[model samples]
Target chain A: MKRRLFLASSIAAALAGCSPIGTALNDNAGFHHALGLEGSLDAALMENLPGLAREYSIADISKNFPVDSLPTPTSVTYDRLLAHDFQSYTLAVVGAVERPLSLSLAQLQRMPQQTQITRHDCVEGWSAIGAWTGVPLRRILQFARPHRDARYAIFRCMDRDDQGTPYYESLDMAQAYQAQTLLALRLNGEAIRPDHGAPVRLRVPTQLGYKSAKWVREIQIVGSFAHLYGGKGGYWEDQGYEWYAGI
Target chain B: MQRLVYRYALLTRLAHWFGAIAVAVLISSGLQIFNAAPYLDAADRSTPTRRVLSIDSPADGIGRTTIFGHSFTTTGFLGWGSDGNGGEGARAFPGWLTIPAYQDLADGRRWHFFFAWIASLAWLSWLVSSAVKGNLAEMILRPSDLHKLWPMQAYYLRLRRDPPPHGSYNPLQKAAYTFVLLVLAPLILLTGLALSPGIDAIAHPLTMIFGGRQFARLWHFVGMLLFVGFVCVHIFQVLTQGFFNQMRSMISGWYRLREHESVGP
Candidate 1:
């Protein structure tokens, strides 16, 4: 009886100890700050190791690639663009640049195209491989002549999340210049479907799927997106997800 | 004669306790993370055909867990459970089983990664310390231990009158510790790294070794289950053998060997 009581007391103490840890960890600024530091360190170390994401063969493409964005943008602007086959759509390149320019779908398609098969890893722990064809984002950055002060490229999309906030994502200059970073126009030889970010989407294989902002309307180069949209850098990033979705 | 022997060293005790806390947090947070998807697919893409295990609540509000072709109603415990507010929600692992006891994937990931660092550092320190002290051999099962495995099992089963003569740990204990520390732990870490796209950018081969990224995720979950299994058996052993003595050894580094157990000079 004494031994059982001792065991019970010890377990109760251990459990009591655990509840404090949970309370201490939840929404703790210090822990979040530490996590951010770790993320930066991780990004720096990963930059040193092969800067390229492994590409797969065409045969490895997933037959049923899941669509991530829910409720598909139902805005009049999106519907109008979809009706017109995105012919009237113009991708504006603004902010921290020598020259702000607007390029149409036809103009973007005419640029140097890179076609590669790569895997898409979502933050929800699902993966899908698909072939994407598009113009390298660096070429567009070069065309616009980004100012030396530019540190991040913010991809603003037309789709609003559940709360009516516009979807946006950002990448550092280093990630923007990556060979695989594309303004993807085509998926699996066909023009991107409306549900899958029709006309254009940013394809960042190095980061998680959320970083690949779809239905991109503007590419705003900025010194820091900390001042823009919740100061966390992106829509999901503002909603408690890590700004650096590399993991 | 009952003898008091110095069993666990101070370093060992510290690492053990630290690891225990870190592991508990990691497991709970990890389950919370898994609750985001609540399905395991062997293929690269999580298609319906390849899904081996899944938990969900349909329009009926009844939670069900499906494994392969078999389905089980795990309502109120697994697929559907509450956060202690009497409001039963459709969460895979339930709130009580997770850190923060609520559906917050971001917080869960934060907790998971934070404790992961702690666990990894402790494991690294334990590894280096044990190697320096030349005490790693004590945890490793050897050819000589092969013969004692059956006798140890028989003793634990109460089929043998006398327990096997061992120093510090029995042969079975050595095997369990050997596998958990050397094989399982490192594999869990590696599989975890494979799930990260950042890590994949650097070490893509790590994902390929497990067939694919999705498979790596599956293997990582399996590794967590194995760790849970090991912990349950370990606690059971501690309770059966001598709870107070085992607890005292782990806490204060002194163990009281029973009268039947031989004592060294």
Candidate 2:
């Protein structure tokens, strides 16, 4: 009986860790795991593939059929959400919200906040530097008042691929409230631009770019991820994108 | 009685050949780009398999070709192509044509980038034309085909050996190819273009697709990893099934089953 109790306690801890607090460490974990198995296998091999060395082109983009946007200009990098025109935008917390707030850009900027200088890793094979400033997602969660049963937060965006379907993303609620997690309004000390989830974007710095859905227009807290578009939470999920975009 | 069915058209043949050459070059050179890896198995030199390449010969050839201060030179022998060209001939200078330019990645990059452009263009046109006429879509699996994938997957997992339902593509094959043609391929191209320094001035949209250069690199590498994973699985499937029939179908575009062959077994 005592042994069973210990096992039960440990299992509870594991489940709790799956929450936002646990998510902080586990988020963006994909990058650490996603950089490719070849890196540690050989350093000399990198010299041969010219296509991957410095730049890929439109022709290259067309070839991959799916890829990310260009690098953000250095000039516009920023520190806080309200510093730019973020106030002009609105944060729509929909889905299972008791009160789906269509918050304007200014409302988010005025909220209690946090700033983090974390690595934003991408699956495309590189990493970059940026200082993000935004309202703690926990603060927004309180405002959204997810019901006692919400299980996930699906991020819907204005961006679309060649197919014209709206791009969508999601995260388990456990990762939604990590202390470092934020709905960022500023990057590198400037207002977030349209290209980088202007107004507000989820900054699960521990996760991959795909996890950090850009140009987020709505936040939907849900009951379960299964059966969401394509039976996965994210837009790319339908097309075989990895669901746990940690790292 | 017997009429020749053009499985692969002339243009497609050209595309396939060039695509083969280009993809081969990209994958081969791609291993070189992953120099961050020290060894594959962490075993002795005898176990010889590079992390990315999976085969370990031609270290000398690869090592010799290094770049410093905008100059490309042969410092020593880095024998990468040895296994490719055959062990004996690889040791020999069968196709040893070295450029005497400075060994900047830019130099090797010229070939990779240009060839990548060519291959992508060819692939895109082929996909579009095929899609417009419904040929490509027909080849790919629909929801129904996906339902049939269980048996094929079972065959793959060693549950059964009844050859998968004969069609333009098995479910996994269609799914993999669709991703390659759609997701993985585009991911690589976008990241590739984003990484290009010179190409930006010519109306590049790397920043738009990804947030920035560093971000682009992160995404590009991930794409390559997926492709690598795909390549590994693809090779395994081909080997496990039958290389001759599978390879011929891809190359010739027509899969010939024996006269008495049926769907199952």
Candidate 3:
């Protein structure tokens, strides 16, 4: 009877130790907010404050950077803007901000710019290094003067899927204000090509490539992403990817 | 008369089963992750190779796995293939062998990370407990063990009729377990961390040690293969030595000693 009791307790202990299993099951059910919260906790505990992704030297840049194909915007407005080489392109900044602004590409170029050589890690198990020049996302957010309640910066893209759902993504306030996060305009000392999310794309060096939305049109600051499309978070997050894809 | 003796400690038994379950789950879920991006390429796929050992066709970018001058089109099985949905897809390892049993990269990552955390923590705890209990001393290789290993190997090869004089473990067993505990386990954990971009942000040195994240990924895959090899040999040994007796020791901490064997102090 003693042996039986020991065995029972051991099994119970083993089962109880597997708390992450519950989180894993929750993630599968499209309620990955719990995992996101866990990730945030881990970041706080394990990472240094204002965590900086590893930067590479100019020599480390790949000769042929692998580019994932970004869908060209099929919208008539996008076509008209593209015809004039995006001269009329004005990035609309709105929602949960004290000052709403519409800044053109030339106006954004006048802002303070940062250039850094960093590796872009793709979710498909590939990585490439490239030198990027862009305005810091934090600088833009500061200019917009986000309201105190604004916790997330939602990126609305010009491109849409077959179902006409616009490609969109969001970053938590902490990530949005990261030093390495940029609204990259140039790659390899040249304007980004159509295949590389031309005009303007997000450069979140610390996160996976998918987190960096391409062909950006508007920036929407929100208190929470609870009522956003599909309500999970980003476009891919709605399609089952984790919103906190820091890994 | 059969004699029953205490073989494993309670902690050892618990850790052993816990590790076994963790590894099984890790390997299956890991395969699912691998299926998302399976190829290991040092150069662009378009780069032309010397025709001598290359079975790659320029028309189709698929490369074949070569062994001992024999080449096989392994793309269908190993690196990239159909998603079983009547459309061409890139996936390594079949759905049946993976955790979710489908091509869901996001879900695969969740399962992998969940078990990885459990396995790594359990490993660290086991290491500490073993060190405190002097289990490491018993497991570590000694000069005397080197002499015993030859005869043990000879016995397994059927050149010798008698087993070597044994303590808690034979020399070969000690060496294998020690390598797994000290070498492979730590390397696997480090490479796993190296593969994570978030971890790299905080611990860049760790990622650099493995020559960057993609290289770390390649090494992680190789490590998984080695672990699978180790498991196969371990199970084979258990079956050959005394399946019931060996399993009983791990499960219940009591082993029925063989007729010729003597219990250790």
Candidate 4:
């Protein structure tokens, strides 16, 4: 009897935690979406469908179906990413820098640290709080010492939308300069999974969680965010989510 | 000699006492719920609400009391009767942390929830034992309970307590407790789990079961209505029942019956 009680209690607790961080973070919005008042799934599926059919030409049905249109909740695996292997992962801190050089993941880890328990606010509206740890973004920018012209920190990721739209997000240089900003390498006391931007992601508190882009491949210290796709600088922005999902 | 016959069983007594304590804490924390909704409390919380929460609690140095939803111990210094209903600007918890807490309202709500699981388990165990030994009515209900529910409602509405030995529990009392345990508690748990965001794969199915978060939220509100109804009915019953006799049964597990024998064979 006691054993049954214990099992039931533990299972309930486990069920409560079933939401993985990504989907879990968006639960509030997910709930609304489930009710048809909001829809992340439909948005995701429809967002990718057109390019999906185009990518899987009748000619290359096998390759394109596997890559572009197979699923709704599929993990964005690292092998498909050009810099999936952290050993080979390289990030070029360029632009206003006095010294522009490519560095490996190990080299980046050797830099200074910043940790914050920030909320990851998805456009869908649920949020999750996790402690993020990484090098202070401002310290890196200070090293870069942007010319007076520099205004934005353009982030490019290893993954991209099918239209060859690279997953990129930008922080206003001033926001990036906040000590809390970081090239986060860990989440909730653990190294990140490839699906969650294995080598590096941005951790910025205050802004909605999605701004903490994962799979960071490049950090270009630039004067303008003009050239980024849709001129909004991120993957979901091209998909019609608001540019700033604060709160 | 006035001897006491056993009424509430030992385990049940334990469960009841714990459940009472839990409710007390929840009601205390519930101040946070009201404070969260800023439009409600118009006046400041520092001053007591003489209008609604005029707690006629005995002067301290006795036991415990709740005024304005804050706890007052026998010691007077700790009691800060900040009425959550009277003012809006003052907060129950810091603002930024509060909403995110609701975002995971299912999380800490789990603390409240798990105890409910224990409460249910404890109740069921007690109930099964009572049913097996044929002591169910003594513990759960009695023939007198029928008239008890709506009985004092009339007296309370009119202000008279002529017919006193009105039985174990009023129909209003029976229904209120039953609904909170059977309906509101379960609805709160299910809807809470549904709001869990799709963490558990089963959470997705729960969304489907409840029709979605908005629908679950609606169901939760319905359960809250049942609770509010029960509350109104419960307070009315309390007023109708002689406060001392009924309260003694609740607090000390012994009701001092005027009659020489127990009702019902």
**Which is the leading candidate under DockQ?**
1
Query: Can you write out model 1's per-residue Cα lDDT over B1-265, one digit (the tens) per residue?
Result: 6779987778888889999999989888898889888988887556668788888886355789999969999888778887534478898887767876777777778778778878988898998898899788777889889899999999878899876888767889888989999999999999988898878888878988987788888889999999989987887777766787888989999888787664421
Candidate 2 segments exceeding 4 Å error: A1-67, A70-88, B1-265
After aligning candidate 3 to the native by TM-score, how far in Å is the CA of B180 from where it should be? 0.8
The interface root-mean-square deviations, each candidate in sequence, come to 2.3, 21.4, 6.5, 17.6
Question: What are the per-residue Cα lDDT tens digits for candidate 2 across A1-247?
Answer: 5644564576456433322231232234553233223222222322122221122222222111122553322222222333555545466788888888988876777777677765454543344446678888888898778998998888877666665577788877766876666788887667866667666777765555667777777888889878776886787556544455441
Candidate 1 global lDDT? 0.84
Measured on C-alpha atoms, candidate 4 has an lDDT of: 0.49
Interface residue Cα RMSD of candidate 1 after superposition:
2.3
Query: Each model's DockQ?
Result: 0.56, 0.02, 0.30, 0.03
Residue-wise lDDT of candidate 1 within A79-150, one digit each (tens)?
999999999999999999999999999999998899989899998888899999999999999999999989
User: On DockQ, who's better, 3 or 4?
Assistant: 3
Stronger candidate by TM-score (1 vs 4): 1
Question: Which window of ten consecutive residues has the lowest lDDT sum in model 2 chain A?
Answer: A57-66
- List fnat per candidate, in order: 0.50, 0.02, 0.36, 0.00
**Candidate 3: global Cα-lDDT?**
0.75
Clashes of 1: 0
| TM, every model | 0.94, 0.38, 0.86, 0.38
lDDT of the candidates, in the order given: 0.84, 0.54, 0.75, 0.49
Q: lDDT of model 3 at residue B126? A: 81
Candidate closest to the true structure, highest TM-score: 1
RMSD of each: 2.3, 23.3, 6.4, 20.9
Model 3 lDDT per residue over B1-265, tens place? 7899997788777788788888877887787777666545333111112112222222243536543346677665543454534443445564445665557777667667766777887788788888999877888778878899889899889999987887877788887888888889999989988876777888888987876787687678778888888987886676556766888888998989878687742
Candidate 4 stretches greater than 4 Å from native? A1-247, B1-3, B27-170, B198-200, B203-205, B228-236, B259-265
